[model samples]
Target: MTNEELEFNNDEEVLTLYDNEGNEVLYRKLLQFYHPEFKKEYLILAEESNFSDEDGDIELIPMISTDDEEGQLLPVETDEEWDMIEEIVNTQMDEPEE
Candidate 1:
């Protein structure tokens, strides 16, 4: 991967992760997954609460995608399955109103 390909920038609230091939594997899926030990660390940082200002680089373990190797796409035949996934994604994207 080149310098630009491995670069991860978080200008806004969105976090974009790119693969070696310059394909976006994951995007804006809550930075909480970056470190499992500390829950809602990103939220705390965003709120500027009692959060550590230390900018530590977190490395993610490589995940083997079955579809990537086999070139197989997810079977989304029925509308129900699509709706279910859509609902789940929507729920994740929703922010709690204060």
Candidate 2:
């Protein structure tokens, strides 16, 4: 899909990838779903490609320029932060009667 056709749902932190036929192929959360290597490759592609519009807003592009090196760095959320998030999710899930 072309850069213009891509969209980012920042509220959900999801990257919605589309097929050549304009069908949704994948939905991945930026913080929760993607592998570190894939994220790195995405970053490299974004760095190398020239965007037609530069209006200071972020855009999602489905195509990856594969000539670039793959990125392999994982996110660095601390254990405490992860634990807190886990606790929050668990608490929400465990909530019972009103």
Candidate 3:
């Protein structure tokens, strides 16, 4: 991907992703950042709904870069990748909101 494409400076709040059965799922964008270690841009998102876990926690989805346009969302493929992404999420959760 080009440097410009990697910017991911999108302003859209909701993103629609299709499931394997061709169902559409809407997600709210939480954050997006470039991973220098993996040389990839990652998009972190949460489902756009009032639903939560039994403990009232919203699940975060981590998406990796794709060869095509930015609308496409690809999941993290490896254990190492998941670890890195999880670390980022943990750090974000540990931060104090202003």
| Superior candidate under lDDT, 1 versus 3 | 3
lDDT of 1 by residue, 1-98 (tens): 12232222233343344556997553322322122221111210122221224664323221211225552222334565445434433443454634
Identify the runs in model 3 with alpha carbons over 4 angstroms from their true place. Answer: 1-12, 50-54
Model 3: ten consecutive residues of lowest lDDT: 1-10
Would you list the rank order by TM-score, best first? 3, 1, 2
Top TM-score model? 3
lDDT of 1 at 37: 24
Each model's lDDT comes to 0.31, 0.33, 0.73
Clashing pairs in 3: none
Show pairs that collide, candidate 2. Answer: none
The C-alpha TM-scores of every prediction are 0.26, 0.26, 0.73
Best-performing candidate as measured by lDDT:
3
Error of 3 at 23 (Å): 2.1
